[model samples]
Target chain A: MEIRTDYADGNYTIHVDYGILEASISEYIAAYSSVHFLVDQNVYALYKDSLLSFVQHPIILEGGEASKSFDAFKHITETLLERGIKRNHLIVVIGGGAAGDAGGFAAATVLRGVDYIQVPTTLLAHDSSIGGKTAINSGHGKNLIGAFHRPKAVIYDLSFLETLPHHELLSGFGEVFKHALLKDEETVRTLMDATRTKISLDMMKPFIISGIETKMHYVTTDEKESGIRKFLNLGHTLGHAIEYKYRMPHGMAVMLGLYFMMYASNEKAARNIFDLDSFRQYFELHGYPLEHLKAIDEVEMMTLMGKDKKNQSSDATGFVLMNDFGQCYFTEIDSNQLKKYISQLKESL
Target chain B: MEIRTDYADGNYTIHVDYGILEASISEYIAAYSSVHFLVDQNVYALYKDSLLSFVQHPIILEGGEASKSFDAFKHITETLLERGIKRNHLIVVIGGGAAGDAGGFAAATVLRGVDYIQVPTTLLAHDSSIGGKTAINSGHGKNLIGAFHRPKAVIYDLSFLETLPHHELLSGFGEVFKHALLKDEETVRTLMDATRTKISLDMMKPFIISGIETKMHYVTTDEKESGIRKFLNLGHTLGHAIEYKYRMPHGMAVMLGLYFMMYASNEKAARNIFDLDSFRQYFELHGYPLEHLKAIDEVEMMTLMGKDKKNQSSDATGFVLMNDFGQCYFTEIDSNQLKKYISQLKESL
Candidate 1:
């Protein structure tokens, strides 16, 4: 299936199929004089022959948290320069979130900007690919230095999902659940009813498409995340802090942050969409680290939240809070109130 | 005088007047919660009290060619992060071309993108500010990494032109001469009639406006520099190669390149508006290194030209050629033809 995102510049399509990489990519190969690949090393080793059939001499990098660093980004850009990559050339990133973020950012900044295609092999990429938010982590934070450049296209091949570990599946589901909770009652109900262990393409397709549509809905209107788009950062405030502090996977940290939000919003009578205990149980069954909420100190967590991009004022922090399903608003939470909520959530845990 | 550039995204204004920075900066300070200045150190030292009245504790950087390196870019970005600069924070860059290019690029990429104001103090900056092309030099070549991010506004206080040295005045004229040639026969006639040594604000204002208008006309329509915008690179092909090889000032190197272009184009019957010897004399009087045309090797220059962003095919390099006044076209020049042109140019010199 093909879904189109319309922007003021032009429209781009997302190609989703059970096995699209092996099927489609000839048009992309024919479009540019040079097609270079920046593949995740693990993905390169596993699917070397398949990728080689499409691209020649792919530059492989360490995937996951390792690839998102500024060092890796510099290496990729320098490699492209050494390879004589020109403006008309295309860079195709074949990997998960980290590879896409770093590679997409390099493509965005190299020669001012260049055309790049995203071939997402992991489920978490369903959220990252559509937004055109590319970045490399700084020593102080993740995605500190970045650009908002849309990819030429996103090719999501469902066949690669079979190779993902169980925890990776759960990590991917964190975003799926986020989109569902932000979407409507029907989506939340559907997500809550799904089995975490027996993951299948048939069961995941709708959720992936739904998540993309939800993201594109925010992105196409506000590509730079100036206004309503901050709603997408519903759980990312603490999620990013936790990810940076503990070196947890992005989606897992986001899952923990979501648990915090659900509890805080419920206590404040700000949102009545979900029963707190039931929702926690659903994520707990999927192996989310819900107990970490109690172990993390309130002061340290608040300090991390202060480092958020949306927190412009040095004294206060802004968060995407919900009072009802599909109704998210950016509200500035006072430091005292935020600390109080954190303490209460910790006590409950 | 105010000139506005309207694009699909938003419109930006250029404020061109004498002594407008102190008078006009208050509105900018009031508009954003944080108005941090990234001023060139020399400029800051000279006008510390004046600048302090507008902004407190501005980030100082070594201006000119020193600040255009990748290392300088990293230092400035890290400084911004260390200071807790956020998405909403405005970065006002005050300096010459290097400061504007490097700081504007940092503002463009930090937190995906941020609002930046350009306060150009040098004559060369009049060209850099309006174009929205920000870049940092790479080891491989100049401007290897950059982005097309337009400034929120360009506050050009013409009073700073008094501090410019005689060579800087000549440097600024290089771009003006190119613009005049591309604009029409009248502009060329106006330019050729002027004395090179006695450049004054009264004489330069019209040319500055003319260059900006020529630039904004192309940039407003094609912000990405993908199509007709390449016309602005009239003398830049060899200009960049010479600049990289000999370490000459950008506009001075461009003046030499323009002399070569005028001579070659006249010989090839590409254009015959101006007498070659008279044009050469005009630039030579301004301290342009016209004689160095014989010193630069044709093969080495050709190799450097191949590294240009516009060169997609390995066999040919594109140059902006003019058959008539105001009719510049990007024509592909093969290596053999380029060598012939260079030999003929040196012999004539």
Candidate 2:
């Protein structure tokens, strides 16, 4: 499948298919004067021979949240400079979200910005690789330091997904689930049905494409997160808090955050759009560690949430809440109200 | 005087006047929910009482090229975070070019970017503050790490230039001279007449405004240095090499570089546009250290020039060369030719 995106800053296409890496990458290589690779270690280990056959001396990064650090950023940029990377040269990032974030940031800031292509390996990256939001975690918070640098293109080869572990798959599925929920009730229902059975690449293909398309809808509308782009942060606000406090996988934490918000906003017309009972069953089946909510200290989580970059002020935390018919809007909730919701959410969970 | 700029990325105003700092800054402070100040140490020391009366606890930086390091960047970001800088807040940078570059970069990447205003203290900053280019030097080269982050406004208080030392004023005049050359011959002749006598604030104002206007022409045309912006690097190609090697003030090095390029490209109808003997006399009158040209090793300078980010390949270095009618265009000069020109330039000097 070929999906084209037109952002105010730049325009690029996303190509998704099984076993399409070699041919797609070769075309890019032929076009650019030179190319460098920044691959995730796991991805390198799984396909080293094939990767080496095409590109030489790839800069390998140990993929995960840990890789998204100032140290990792310094290493990649310095190594690339030592290797004599130029302004015209392209850096192809082949990995999951963390690898892409770090490598993309290096690409963005190196020589004041360079072109790059994203080759997302994990399922979660399906959501990340599309947005121009490249970042590295600062000492204070996740994605606190970054830029809105869009990629030249994204090549998603489903072949890499076959090697993903179950937890990794579940992690990626969380974003897919969020995208579906943002899309429509029918899409969410279809995704829930797909999860009920054993997950496979065949079942994931259409949903992944749809998820990217749905994300692009918001991304294209608000490239810099000034308006509609906030909607995409559906579960991310509280999700980031839980993930940081418990060191949980991003999407699983997002899943739990989504439940909390749904529980908080699940009233009147919102209840019609979001079926709480059905989502709870889905969460239970997916093994999303809901126990984190019970164990989480309300004050600590609230403190973390208060530090969220989205919040406008210390007294209130901003959230993208759903209204009737799944329509999302940004609103500020005070600390007391949020604390109340957290306690109630923990008990309910 | 107020000048407005409209670039593809953003639009902002540049206010140039004498003693406009307090009034201009107060206006911005009123508009923003909160504000933080990043002031140069020298400026703070010079105007401590006045500065303290306005912004409390301003972040003071030792103003120099050394301040444009990763360490300084980390310090500023961490300090701002600790002080509770929010998205709605603004960072007012009060310094010369170096402080603006570092502080602007911190503003650009912190929380993925915040609005900033530039309060230039030195004459040289007239050029740097207007451009959206914000950066820090890497171990490999100058400005290897940065972003194209535009400022909300630029407040160029001419009063600050009254206390500028002779060398700093000369350094700034180099850019003003370059800007004049890029403009019509009449402007260059006027600038030459202005520099022949004792320098004062009144004499510098028109040149600074015209220089900024000339720079904005190129910047607005190509916000990202992909096309016409290359012309603005007229003296910068060799200027950067000399500055890096000799630890010279930026514009002073640029003055020498401009002389070399003019000599290299001087021939036929080009002679009508450029007067080498007159320029040499101007350099001598201004106490520009032209002997550095003779002292510079050709091979070492060539290697340094080769590493310039603008170069297309190792074989040929890219330079913005002037045509017969003062029209500037980018061209690649082979290393052997560049080396030969360097020796000839040294002899001519």
Candidate 3:
């Protein structure tokens, strides 16, 4: 299936299928004057022969949050230029979120701007690859430096996910869960039921599409994240803090973040829409490292949360509070209030 | 005079007047929740008291081409983050092209993007500030890394030019001259007449406005420089090569680049539109350092031109060649032909 995105700044399509990577890449190569591939090192190792058959010298990048740094950004851009990447040339980013973010940013700023296609190998990238948001982590914070550069297309081939480890699959599913939560109670219920079974591409494909669509809904309305797009960050405020503090996988952190927010903002109606007990059971069943929530230093997490780009004031941390499924709004909670909630969340977890 | 630009990507006004800096900045400060100033060091020193009155702790930047580096970009973004610059805050860039380019890029990439106002302090900036072409020099070439991020407004306070050194003024005029050449012969003649007399605020204002209008014409029509916008780069191909080689003022190199291209693509109608000899005389009269053209190493220059972002192929260099005023086309000339033209240009110089 193909999902087309209509953003205020740009428009592109997302193609999701079982084994469409080679054909999609070949198509782009035929369309553009030239193509440059920026692939995850692990993905390169896994698919070395097939990748080499198509790409001349794909730029290999370490595939993790750590690789999304200024140094990596410089390396990718410098390497691309050295290889004579030009304006008309397309940069095909074949990796998870890290390679995509850094490589997408390189495509955004290199030669003022160039076109790129996102080939997501991880389930987590299903959400990230759809948005034009490209960034490299600054020393101060994650994704502190970036640009809203849209990709020409996103080719998500699920066959690659077959090689992903259990933890990595869980990492990507975290975002899928967040999307389902943001969508509606029905989606949340369906996603919960889907994950109850052993993870498979067939079980996840529909959720992935729905998740990207939900993300695109906010992104298309506010490409710059000035308004509704902030809704997409429902769990990310605490998610980023957790990821930063514990050096955990992004999606894994986000899953915990979702539980914390749901617990903190546990409105009567929201609880009716999303049952906290069942969600806890799901986490425990999936082995989501709920223990990390108990270990989080409230002060450090609060400090990191305060630095979130979404925050409007220094005194408060901004959050996307969902009163119920399909309903969310941005609110700023004072540090003291937030710290109390953190304590309550830890005790509950 | 105020010139409003209508670019496809964005629209902004260019305010060309004397002593408007203080008022313009004050207006923005009153409007935005908060404001940050990124000022050229020299400009800050000259207007320190006045600037301090309006801005607290202005980010002072080195004012020339050397500062347009990735390191400077990192420093600006890091420092801004350190100082607690948020999304709603405005970044008022007070400098010439280099500072504006670097600072504007920081505004563009920091937090994905933010709004910025351009306070052009040099004549050259009247052109650069309006276009939203923000960039930093890469190891490979000038502006090899950047984005097409527009400013909210450009406060072209002519008062800043009063403090500019002669060469700096010349650098700015190079763009004005290029704009005039891009425009009809009437503009060229009028600009020539204006420059022939003592350079004064009143004398330069009309040309600066006209020059900006000329630039906006191409920019508005083709914001990404995919088509007609290439006309604006008539002199820049060789001009950038000259600037990179000699470390000369941008406009001065452009002035010589203009002369060389005019000579190489010396069509009969074009000569009628722009007199090469008189244009050369204008450069000499204004101390444009034409001897740099004589010092040109053809091979080195060819290599530099080959690396220009505008080039489409390795075998040839792309150039904007004019048959007459307002009539130019993009063409690719082989290295040998370009080198022969370079030597011929050297001999003529």
DockQ of each: 0.73, 0.75, 0.73
Q: What is the full ranking by TM-score, best candidate first? A: 2, 1, 3
Error of 2 at B199 (Å): 3.8
Query: What local lDDT score does residue A143 receive in model 3, on the 0 to 100 scale?
Result: 90
Model 1: residues >4 Å from true position, as ranges?
Answer: A51-53, A196-202, A270-272, B49-53, B200-202
Give the per-residue lDDT digits (tens) of candidate 3, residues B73-94: 8888888888777888889998
Give per-residue CA lDDT, model 1, range A1-349, as digits (tens): 8889978876788998776785567677678988889999888878777634556788887878688776686688878888888998999998998889989988998888899999988888888888898988776688888898899889998878888877787788778888987898788887666664554455888889988999889999898787988999988888888888888888899999888777767766765555888877777776789888778887888887877777877777788877877888777888899889889888987
Error of 1 at A12 (Å): 1.3
Stronger candidate by lDDT (2 vs 3): 2
lDDT of each: 0.83, 0.85, 0.84
- Candidate 3 residue pairs in backbone clash: B124-B172
**Candidate scoring better on DockQ of 2 and 3:** 2
Worst 10 residues of 1 chain A by lDDT: A193-202
